[model samples]
Target: NPLMQPNAIEKISYGIDEAVKATGLGRTFLYERMASGELKSIKVGGRRLIRVADLMDFLQNAANQRIS
Candidate 1:
């Protein structure tokens, strides 16, 4: 069931390390973002995880920003 659940949108989860790498952020910076709620995460049995979709959306938003 655990394996099958990841295939579903509602059952998504990501490890902190993976999220950090995906966002290209350092450890402290990643934690700061998490603390500020700029990056959304979920707690699972004493660990934190990010949603892949959320990260994708964040990246898309960043890409859409226009340079001033």
Candidate 2:
């Protein structure tokens, strides 16, 4: 059942390194977006993790912007 969920919903959150890998963006770029409030993330202990849903939404929004 673990593999049955859509990738978008499968993951709860991803650390900065995983987020950068998943988004194909540089660490600095993601950090900047996090600081700018353009992207949403949660602090788990001392680590900041981006929600999978938020990451997907951000990518979709970026695509829509390019099409516009």
Candidate 3:
């Protein structure tokens, strides 16, 4: 798909907006997760960013929890 192939450069980190879009999660929910330490995020120059690997790990752990 050309649409999917347009951005070959993978992102190492994502701001709140991008993270919400990528994860299909609500903005408030993401903040809640971050606040609860369920999801890890970092603040850089007043902007909050989540690492791609951390996001992936969060999702994987959530999935595993559901299975158990």
Candidate 4:
């Protein structure tokens, strides 16, 4: 009990660096996608954040395209 770790909190959004780490995609590529409107992101103050749902949707759509 004392040594047990707490459950990790799921992230609702990720900054550019966090997204890169989560997806293993390069920063340039991610920025390109954002610029092209393939991937959606929001500007919060000075930070750009990508919603987890949007990221998942982007990956799922890509997979579907590959399958088709």
TM-score for every candidate vs. truth? 0.64, 0.81, 0.87, 0.87
In the range 1-68, model 4's lDDT, one tens digit per residue, is: 32464676768999999999999999999999999999999999999999999999999999999999
- Structural RMSD, model 1: 5.1
lDDT of 2 by residue, 2-30 (tens): 56655544667899999988879999998
Cα miss at 44, model 4 (Å)?
Answer: 0.3
* Model 4 stretches astray by more than 4 angstroms: 1-7
Worst window of 10 by summed lDDT in candidate 3:
1-10
Itemize residue pairs with steric clashes in candidate 3.
none
Least lDDT summed over 10 consecutive residues: which range in candidate 4?
1-10
Q: What would the per-residue lDDT of candidate 1 be over residues 1-68, giving only the tens digit for each residue?
A: 55777775553657888777666877787678779877777888898888888777766766777542
Instruction: Determine which window of 10 residues in candidate 2 has minimal summed lDDT.
Output: 1-10
Candidate 3 segments whose C-alpha is farther than 4 A from its true place: 1-7
Report the alpha-carbon TM-score of model 3 versus the true structure.
0.87
Q: Stretches of candidate 2 above 4 Å error?
A: 1-9
Question: Which candidate has the top score in lDDT?
Answer: 3
Q: lDDT of candidate 4 vs native?
A: 0.94
Error of 2 at 50 (Å): 0.2
| Superposition error at 1 for model 1 (Å) | 24
